[model samples]
Target: MASPIKSYVPYSIFLIALLLRPSSLTTAADFSSSVCSGTLDPSRCFQVIKTIPGGGQAPSLESLCGTAISFSLSKGNQFHSYVQSLAASASNPKLKQVYSSCAENYDDFIGNLQSAQVMLKRQDYNGVSTMASSSMTEVDTCSDSFKEGSVADPSQLIDKNKYYYTLSLIILRISNKLGGAA
Candidate 1:
């Protein structure tokens, strides 16, 4: 029979190689699909993620969550500023009122997102989800205000609101997947 030590040489090398390797190596596409899997609309989630700068290459699930919250915050701030400018410039009293209300809504939305950012830093995924849901409610309230006012929709304002709501849903769903704190 072959010597026992010689028989085990190849097995030992193989085990060593396995131990040295990373736990799992997944491609960016794999990461995207997995990260987007549990969302309300996986397809939309993937598309939205891809639209964010460097989003497609998120190295891990937590990083993906960060990307979503950070992008939403940035977009919320931009929308808030836009609404404020609209509120200032709108000549029609009804339009001005709608814009002013939207500005306030955006303010609350931004606050929720800011809170979500903190929760994300703390790895409190549930807390982040709650904040995202609250942010979505703000958007919904703003949309409802528009419908109630019957003001002519400003160029892209309504569409942006709808899009942000969808983004908020994405954030909430993704955060839910992580469960509670790490």
Candidate 2:
């Protein structure tokens, strides 16, 4: 017959091993899926972003706008400089307007992303999360607009944004499961 203490020791070791294992190890795939789905839903984006460490703070609309303004100015200046370099440039007013509008929107999006990155660096989880969610929403809108023919040739942008968003969401979920976030 086995001694009682020896019998319990194996069970105790097994329990400890089980407890020591990271929880996220099992649900990584699920989190990846959530991020993929969230690309189409801002709410989902919010949820996913909230799970990441340094990603769950609110953002100031004013700050976002200011960033947008600066981004737009820089973008506009660069485009103007590029246009000046064109030797035989004959600008179409309509095309120029469209391009400018697109550039502005792009700048705004980039600004939002930069702000979110800063928040993340500061360990402002909530702010980063909120901004990330908003960014996801913007991407979703861009995707839908492209699909609806409201935007032209958005495939490259969609693919690029989607890939990063999905990766972040998956990483967040895994981190959460790992007890990186409460």
Give the root-mean-square deviation of each candidate in angstroms. Answer: 4.0, 10.7
Cα lDDT computed for each candidate against the true fold: 0.83, 0.45
User: For residues 1-182, could you state the per-residue lDDT of candidate 2 as single tens digits?
Assistant: 98999989989999999999855353433443433453456565544444433322213222332333344335434543443332124255443443444344445555555675566456565665565455545545544544554445422544544633543343333223233343
* Model 2 misplaced regions, further than 4 Å: 1-14, 23-34, 37-92, 137-182
TM-score, per-candidate, Cα-based:
0.79, 0.42
> Residue 136 CA error for candidate 2 (Å)?
3.6
Residue 87, model 2: lDDT of: 15
- Alpha-carbon error at 74 in model 2, in Å? 15
lDDT of 1 by residue, 95-169 (tens): 899999999999999999899989999989889999999999999988888789988886568877877887787
> Which is the leading candidate under TM-score?
1
Cα deviation of 2, candidate 1, in Å: 13
Off by over 4 Å in 1: 1-23, 35-42, 180-182
